[model samples]
Target: MPTETEREESWLTRDELEDVRGRVPMLYVIAVPVRVGEAGDLDQVGLLLRASDTGRMERELVAGRVLYHERIRDALVRHLEKDLGPMALPRIPVSPQPLTVAEFFPTPGVTPYHDPRQHAVALVFAVPVHGDCAPQQDALELAWLTPSEAASTDVEAEMAGGHAVLLRQVLAHLGQTL
Candidate 1:
């Protein structure tokens, strides 16, 4: 087994990450936690309330980069649990596939999505969660909003980094027109 230090090396150091960010597009998993109503219909979407690196509060989906040796499904579960707490009970697929691939550009207007830090290609998954989700890490709250409420202009305005666009994509994948 790898030692603790070896395990820690699975993550990129700050300088290493910045150097790589300038060279290539990073792969990330964007997990959108959702709820299924009793009738087997989509109930709500979970959005995290947190402060961005700039100290402005924003709503966001659970997201993170996939480690060098990590599986995509594992990356999804890790980010979901880290942001939504251990009891979030995210439903991960045995054979995972993304609902869509969202490409984020460093330049604005390049796409509907923008990420000023680095160009990233993200695999988007709609994870149906069943258990209680107390916000974890930097998350201040987990808001479960109906599809309509989530797609509202007001809610979209509160989300930076084009997360609202991603949410809309997930909603459309789930058969919600909005």
Candidate 2:
């Protein structure tokens, strides 16, 4: 994880970011890290809790922007480490392509996913983590829920920005469903 100063030096400022966002859709990668048991069954789904701009707690996936010089795999690894801590051993899929793509719009009603900051095109994947996980930085906690529990109405309601939809999609991709 880079410091604020380092991030500032490497990335664009708010105004410059706005200009870029206006020109084209930004690329992003989202990871739904999971925990599988010895039998190769998904035992838990990792959910990240972070404080949103509205000062409320919102559930989200492990996600971040794709850097100019970075590949999708690198971006996925970067975000997983940034949010889940360095100790988390993320098992990235062999394929470079994502299981699904989520188009996030700036307007509330434009899509299932909404990001008021920018129009983000996100490639979403489900990763399996084998080691310790400590939610870092802005994340409040890392909650692991069973597939059924995660699909429950309570969990869905807690997730913001249409991540619940993405969550269900991941489960469906894994051959499980609500």
List runs of model 1 lying over 4 Å from the truth.
1-9
Candidate 2 lDDT, 113-152, residue by residue in tens:
9988889999999999988999999999999999998888
Score candidate 2 by lDDT.
Answer: 0.90
- At residue 125, candidate 2 shows an lDDT of 94
Residue 105, model 2: lDDT of: 92
lDDT, candidates in the order shown: 0.92, 0.90
Name every residue pair that clashes in candidate 2: none
Clashes of 1: 0
Which candidate achieves the best TM-score against the true structure?
Answer: 1
TM-score per candidate, chains pooled: 0.93, 0.91
